[model samples]
Target: MTGHVVWHGRRVAFRRGESLASALMAAGVHNLGQAATGQARGVFCGIGQCQNCLVRVGDRLTEACLLICEDGLIADPDAGGRDG
Candidate 1:
């Protein structure tokens, strides 16, 4: 089956070799979360060199830009945690 992932209780469809950040952007999810002091943040760097596009995959923090879209992957854009 084609790759897919969930975001904040919404099932998002993705394709093979697609990045989580790209999937999110395609789904119109631009604002990922806040930074140190609850500041708005998103994909600053398309690569994995930045922490702007961090998201909560289950309970662990992952870089959306670097994480490949996988089937049944659960992600919380507003997890209310550090990465959220």
Candidate 2:
């Protein structure tokens, strides 16, 4: 099944079983957030090993590469407090 998730307040479509990182990247959202040194961060390991893809899902910080895309899922890049 296909559905949409809220990314930075915008709706991004994704298929069931797809990771949040994959879906966001497919939707042209490459820059997930900023690093502590003001460098842009994105998917690196694609297996949740790297902390580059961290984003705030609701109130908790998680790796987007490991997070499955679900309907109505909300991801806020700025909420992770990594925006430098």
Candidate 3:
């Protein structure tokens, strides 16, 4: 099944088994957020190892590559900020 998630307040569609990173990338959202040094961040390793695809899901930080896309899910790309 396919559905949409709230990505940075924008709706991004995804398949049921798709990861958050994959969904965001398909929507042309490459720049997930800025690092502490103001460098742009995105999915690097494509796995949960690099910590580059960090996104705020609810009140916790999680790897976008590891998070399965869910309908109506709210993901804050910029929520990582300096602490990411």
Q: Which is the leading candidate under lDDT?
A: 2
Candidate 2: regions farther than 4 A off: 79-84
TM-scores for every candidate against the unseen true structure:
0.85, 0.90, 0.90
lDDT tens digits by residue: candidate 3, 1-84: 489999878999999899999999998999887777778889999979999988888877899999998899998865346543
Over the stretch 56-84, how does candidate 1's per-residue lDDT look in tens digits?
87767889999999899998765346432
Error of 2 at 61 (Å): 0.4
Question: Residue 15 deviation, candidate 2, in Å?
Answer: 0.8
Off by over 4 Å in 3: 79-84
RMSD of each: 2.3, 2.0, 2.1
RMSD of 2: 2.0
TM-score quality measure for candidate 1:
0.85
* lDDT-superior candidate, 2 or 3: 2
Residue pairs in clash, model 1: none
